[model samples]
Target chain A: MKMRVHSSCSAAFSARCSRQVAPRAASAQAPPAVQVDDFDFQKYVMATAEKVNVALDAAVPMAYPETVHESIRYSLLAGGKRVRPMLCLASCDMLGGEESVAMPSACAMEMIHTMSLIHDDMPCMDNDSLRRGQPTNHVKYGDDIALLAGDALLAYSFEHIARETKATPEQIVRVIAEVGRAVGSIGLVGGQVVDIKSEGKKVPLETLEWIHVHKTAVLLEASVVTGAIVAGASDDDVERVRQYGRNIGLCFQVVDDILDVTQSSETLGKTAGKDLDSEKSTYPALLGLDESRKIAQRLNEEAKALLEPFDAEKRAPLVGLADYIYSRTN
Target chain B: MKMRVHSSCSAAFSARCSRQVAPRAASAQAPPAVQVDDFDFQKYVMATAEKVNVALDAAVPMAYPETVHESIRYSLLAGGKRVRPMLCLASCDMLGGEESVAMPSACAMEMIHTMSLIHDDMPCMDNDSLRRGQPTNHVKYGDDIALLAGDALLAYSFEHIARETKATPEQIVRVIAEVGRAVGSIGLVGGQVVDIKSEGKKVPLETLEWIHVHKTAVLLEASVVTGAIVAGASDDDVERVRQYGRNIGLCFQVVDDILDVTQSSETLGKTAGKDLDSEKSTYPALLGLDESRKIAQRLNEEAKALLEPFDAEKRAPLVGLADYIYSRTN
Candidate 1:
């Protein structure tokens, strides 16, 4: 396995670098041999994420009126894990494609995700003061500017995919459709509405599950599937990647819910027990701690299973990613 | 013209349908027919608007985790003029293109526009209590939903362009870029930021122009250019169409300014003099009513001149549209 370990997080991800799936048990198991680690995949994914940020920034304020450019820039550059876009680039690499072809779509996915976050933090909605350890746009720039910024980012994401990259016409079209489906009623936005509506009400478990799957999972699916499509993967391959993304996304959320309960605000960069504070439905809230933990473990395994057909080396980063997701305490 | 008239208002339009461009001055000197008055364009644009609305209503509430999606949908479906999409569809007609190719782009444009409006009405922004004669989304659903609704619409707009339309991928891509440019900081969002920043301060005339052109005119330009592009018009033809749209857009704003001063709330269906009440810089404020009126007239004439090369029949609707734009008191 090739490695591009940044010193700051080295200790934390050393075992992860080997690309071997971590043992599900809490007790320390010896790390798997490093032979299967695919360093190129991780590097490619990160590099593409950076490139996407740059492209997104360049494409925005310049394309809009200067008055609102700074606000748009605020959220566009707001740092995050860049997970969704990384999924796009990594999946592309895993399927025998270069990042260049998939870069636009990768950037687009991030733009869409970032836009959602910006809007989600507005005074009218979440009214959140902070995100990813920074003041929300509405807090920094005021609500109007924040709103326009999010709007610009969303609109610009599609333009970036359509105009910035040279993907095949069919690919571009498919990407657009995929993006729409993820963001539309059956996907991200739809999920958001139901989630909001369920607030203060005791939501059915099925309803809660549907919300998570649509709002959070759909875009995750889009991120991975888009990469596969850009790489010209077969439909079956795309579906497999989507399944992997879905499991990982859910695992990621479940961990987030757990961390909200267990971690300090200082580490999480958000209020601890936010879900509890808000009385929002969460896995642990619905299933209890032990049951939720089991669910996360099962999901991690399911995600791993989806990647089984790919070369062991090609699948390393993804498998490692599943472990890393489940491992996050904050 | 092959026209489908669905409503009583639209039925009148078919009766008066003529492919020939009305003599330009004839409309200016006499009462010009407003297409919004014409039942076909009115009904067609309206139906398209409704379609967009349905999609918006269905999609915006999908945001996951509950509270978010509810917040997004509450405001997005509130009534609007649906002008952006209508302009897009009208532009397609001017280019002799089928509506099928232009429908998605038209809907996307409206979504972008609606996103802007929703954000503008937030409690932290204009903080308006009413929109389209109804309680603003924030006023009804709370600020959170309004914020999310705007975000969902913006993201969905691009997705719609990419996924729903039958236009070629290149066309979809181009439309996305065109619309994105209109929404970005350099465009509507940028103008808005400047507008907010410049509030209570004297801004340069150039800066003010920059704000309006990017914020308002760019989308208008995009509306027409996208229509032409999807319709497969020649570049020169598209440029010509854009010139026409540009003139009309400016003229429309000028008229709006006039209406803001002269029209009553009952006639306008929204707050009248809201611009003056806010002390916002407007054409009437900047240039005074008489001069603004003249400017609108000149703009209307210039807009007509751009359509001179179009076959006389194809130019009729636009010429009438220009006259109606300038002549309207509200």
Candidate 2:
């Protein structure tokens, strides 16, 4: 309640102008494990992701309304890197909260992320048929079921957080506000509508960044920021973490763009070169591959620098994540 | 917090079997304006709807993301009966809470209701073109914007409730939980999926009831129940309101089925006889018109009976609303 909820809602967009940071680029090398030698980031990711997967499974079971649940579970559990949830938990951990405190919000982030994917893959939207080495949600469940699955997942994301999160009423309400704003029109859906409209058009560089920032970066920002709020981070701390999230979020997509061109479909696990094949503008398409790589490096570095004032031990996970995103193969 | 959250989620369906209330019928003569002689229920509805419209407009402004916001406002503000918001406010009023206490949530109910309509009208769903006498949301906004508009409206409903409600955090959180569950799988979305699957051919009476209960009745139940919660209604009180809501919710839809056959599209202000046109099962189609009328009357009577324990004057709106649903023409 102490924080400005509306400001947080749009800070992701406004902060972009203030920071004047190059949006993102793409490339990967070995993770800079030296950020925290003893942290064992890889093992932490596996353990945390395991917990997230288990909770997500319980969140939406194969209940009597079987078909929709089946579709929701299919894509939700369809094995991805789970970068968003990990960032949420790690952000919460950095602020000295018990993992359990932010676990529900962390799970909620994945649900929202999963819902977006399910909807985006519909025939009326992106029309992609393959996701995560399997058929897209619409292909498997038909468009209507897939659509309802996404809607249900989106609703449940907020429900799960509101019902399960162990936080103050103020914090819980703020978290819901943040999560809701993150995915609403000005956030994910807004970016998506533009992306749909921009397809096959030679969109300008700013428009492309606007689309990526809103579509891809906003939820990632919400994931980390909501986790921080659940953990009782100060307003200053929350704002700082917001910038970190924004950078990594954009970087994650830029890396996906780079990998789309550089890697094969087999390595990406979904369709590769999808952006290029569809004539969609990406970081590499707009900024060139080498410049995109430099921008990605700068974003990853900026993301890490924002974490400098926090406890080295506590912030190690976040630091490690930026490196991981910058270095991951897929 | 004392009331069971999940129970409210499915209480609309379970209470149906326990009560063995015939799953709604169809007819309306006129609203029983005598429920409270001085109440002037028509004025109450119009006045409450105007307040809700203004609040909804402010809740989502025509911001920078012009297209998506326009799509959201297009269907949202395009005008409808505003039954959900009025029910919410009336319930809150009956429970001795200020109208302002539930106004935001009331608007949210409309927003969620609007989102459903937008999504349902898409080619991937029911594929309608006219709503409230204007082109459907997707027809004007395109399929992508309409889809995203629905998604944004749904998300903002929770955010609006969380940020705008003046209730205690626990109360606000409970409201969020109730609204979320109402629209989630066990609620609205659960019903929608079954409905899509049940389309064409002949679905059993039980299957049809399940769809109506979930798709139509669940959110109405949530509307009144959430208002009761925001007003600090006790668990027993909440359950009482839940039953009343469930009956009236089903009753509302049954009346629509009847009206579909009896009223002209001009009177109904949209496509008439859509149910029969699509071979969709309906109360009148299965139970005969007279039987449907009798059932509608019985449901209205039963809904009123559930409010007998409360003060008559305070509960006047509820009684008036039940009568109004049964007696409505268009």
Candidate 3:
């Protein structure tokens, strides 16, 4: 792919977004035959994740409700991989939108993602005590503060978008509606209910897909779709972006299931094969590891194919992200 | 108070808003000495409550994952007085806006109110067994579903407003910001943390007010503020409306405190004296009952006085609603 990526993470991003000089330098080691610009996918991901983290830290400050804010800050800053936010920023970047315009929404994606994790780890839900290499929100802050922290984060996500996003009111409202549905009963919550209901029971592939599609894929779709919308992409383009997002989202879940069975707890940072212990149906469990890997490969290939119609250089981050999701061990 | 009220709730409201002819008739049997219009406070509340209930029922349908939706419907449709919604409607009505313009926000207020109750009643929080004359959401639905149900309702409230409200997108975004802040850590959840911390201790009067103001009054303020904003009211007028809302909100809490001490569980529909049993500070506990009642009266008067500058006929419902709050026994 034709690309503008370079060694410096912030420099490559700022070259596209900022009026200042593009301090970005193309790789000096490029072969004379091809003169290819090697896109530093890891650096791009790191750069975007840093921006999301900074915005999030400033977004929710410790105030009078110290415990809840402390609780919110704890899980929020708990050092997740920030994959959802990276996807959001990458989509916006691909569509030639400024990082400043999409940063609030990019941070909001992480906030919702964090809230799902916090609530999912509660005693009433999965009851997992560890997440992202640290004690869970409920495990560290106690259930009451943990619940309120999740709720505060959820409520604040819309508020942060509405209050901070430098978009037209129409676009902001659209983003809110898009985001609300992604987390509402029909989206993450719906998938959760089904997953909870189906635990320890015989499950079909379709049902398992439904669980992951809603629980995992829907928010990822929303993250990308919203970024595309904020970038003023046309409806047709947004739909294509949605399909791309959906493929990667499902691919991410398939990879997760594979990792659960194949990777040890030392690498995954949580109990390996816990889903098997709980009898939760997963891609690898339902369709052997090899088949699940094949499905993931198909998903990633389809995801990148959808991006071909866009500018190849500008779409490098998303293409790289899909590859990262497919190849990562954890 | 010179007023435009009549026997029928729909008639009285329609007279002010719809182009349809006002079938509203002034009281034929007005006292000859004063020639006063008797605003039927009961019918206005009942009528507005009916409208809010219909909107709420239409807002959340039982789609997939029936359990969460059922839990949401249970607490949402459970017969509270619909006080928050009525206050929202009353604010819009007083500002001369159509009920249709504000009805979605009106229902949204109740959605938020219901969410707070659901979260507050979980065993990790207040652990209440009964609410609005029925079992609490967590008591009826399992804790997991109950938590998700509350999360769903809270998420849907914003979606409903953004999707359904007919106002300008700016107005809707502003309303979302307002409502979101009202429920965030520094709003309802903030007050809740303080309340929880203060339990089984001698909380000061100031601390008690702080708790109720955040936990209770913040949402009330948002409810009225959102309604007025959707009605196209100016900032100064909205602030005036805000003052009126704050007074009524504080008054409602004080009366709740008094009833907790004076009323029985059977009469008040829930465990009335449970606040005392938990050693939670209340208006009557911090101040003598006589003083607390006097404060409610003062608050009610101040609340009504703020509405005096508006068209007397237009403000009748709000005036009557404040009076109803003051004189209410349960």
Candidate 4:
């Protein structure tokens, strides 16, 4: 497959090129010669995000006990990049799975992601008042309701997948077990605990990597792997997707850390410099900005390499997603 | 299938005799009448509680990120009646399943119960400082860690069941789905929202029952049903156990409401008069104390009646558990 560059990048990504060693040159060196320009990465992301939004809107409703439902809906329905769900859907699509079959798991991934955000923004946690350009759940509802809403979302995530997925019971069970592990103590919560304890301390790079791997990478890995499992991918294929997910997952956080210092609060839609303000060790803090950017670029390339063996056309969206995750820094 | 009653009631239960509308007379009317002094209900409860404690102690380890594990262990290991787990174990035992096969789900029940308690004790929720005669999780660990710990437990509940359950994958999936429903918006979380919303207001008896059914009964229902499911119970058998669980589950809450009015905080191990202080509707608040006690007794009998079809000796623990739940108010 011949590779060509997409000419149009979003304005948000424009700033990324100036700050780092050239990413395009690095990505150009390794490829199965694919025509990238034929695949509109931005259009794919926006389309997938739109579908995910519609599915998510239907996933949670404002029912009885309106406050709790409202609290869950408020954060969930609020707009985001929809990266997790998009990744999930794209992975499923690449494996010849119907979007309808994968929709519930896709929505479940988003719900899980939203839950972490809701709890992470609690007063006792990050004490943040804003998220995604609006008041956080705790700010809109009280802390008790916010916490409950997060919990409801977490529980609902598993229920939604089990109830809605058209996959076989075996696939559904595997998905549930995998997703459960991704969010359990040894996963998201485990990482958050370590991150919390390490705050304001001079932390080792190994510890920082541990935190991100558990907190961030595991869930992303779950998202991609669940989609593939639902689509009935073989073990080898699933493992390959998992590696791609892990690489891009870590890259997602590394870029996020880079944006914390580089972007304005308006552009990021969250408090800029909060990481530095809290003295939390980040990729940029631990490694210099140039080193961090280079690492993120390398991770993005490695994630792409994992997908090279697949049909280039089928893997286009995923390949593009890795670039988008890195390109967000612009 | 002979049915018998235990003659000696604990001192706490002696007072229940006069207020209840002749529970003995109601029970005596049922068939398979045998000696009342044969089974020791209290002994069975204590033995089952001890086994549950040992299983729970091994369920969560003080691994790395000891803080979250500690927070989970702190509340989980803290003493409670272990009523849910006992019911689960008893249900599985009645179905001729090994206790080892049911232990994971039993531990999951306790974990889920502890999660609801921890979140309920948050400052913004019930705002209670004491639980199980010790400081609540939020009081011991900061609210942040407590919230995370609760989330961790909820996720781990599913993981523990999925990973540790010896049942078929289909059964494990069904259990996970059932539990997710139990704790989701339509179950524990939903009931809590209504309870919080109804605070300080005059709620109807219907609404009070709704709150108790969803908030309390569902988890207990899940506990028993999951155990039966894990044991590969027949559909008819599962349905019977579910009914038994529902009756006792509702009975569990009604007795709790009665005790809140009749017992001391020291006796309850958590603050008493909380329902009155918060002015939230309870069974006793909607119905008179005598009526509530009568309802609790009636529920206990109805629960026992459902077990009449099963082998009496096999169901002894469950039958005795219904008595223990009601006897707690004594």
The top-ranked prediction according to lDDT is: 4
On residues A1-330, what C-alpha lDDT tens digit does candidate 2 reach at each position?
022211221221122221333323333532332334455565566777799899888888899689999999999999766778988898999998889988899889999999999988888787889988899999998888888899999999999999999989899999999999999988899889888888889899889888988999999899899989988999999999999999988888887788889988886777788899889989999889999888888888789778877876788778767766765566
lDDT (Cα, tens digit) per residue for candidate 4, span A203-318? 99999988988889988899899989999999999999999999989988898899899889988778889999999989999998999988888888788878877777888888
Arrange candidates, best TM-score first.
Answer: 4, 3, 2, 1
lDDT tens digits by residue: candidate 3, A1-330? 324333322432222222211222334542121111367665667767777788889999889868888999998987777878888887888887887888888889899999999999999888898786688888888999889988888999989989988888998999999999999999999999998898998799999999898999998998898888888888998899999998989988998999898889877777688899999999988999989988887887678777776765677788766666766666
- lDDT, residue B257, candidate 4: 92
Off by over 4 Å in 4: A1-5, A10-30, A33-35, B1-5, B8-37
Which stretches in model 2 have alpha-carbon errors above 4 Å? A1-34, B1-35
Leading candidate by DockQ? 4
Which CAPRI level is candidate 4? medium
Q: At residue B92, give the lDDT of candidate 2.
A: 92
What is the lDDT ranking, best to worst?
Answer: 4, 2, 3, 1
Predicted complexes: DockQ each: 0.50, 0.70, 0.70, 0.74
Interface RMSD of each: 3.0, 0.8, 0.7, 1.1
Q: What is model 4's DockQ versus the real complex?
A: 0.74
TM-score of chain B of 2: 0.88
lDDT (Cα, tens digit) per residue for candidate 4, span B190-253: 9999998899999988899989999999998998898899889999999999988888889989
lDDT per residue for candidate 2 within B192-225, as digits (tens), equals 9887777675878788788888999988899999
What's model 1's lDDT at A175?
Answer: 82
TM-score of each: 0.85, 0.89, 0.90, 0.93
What's the CA error at residue A59 for candidate 1, in Å? 4.6
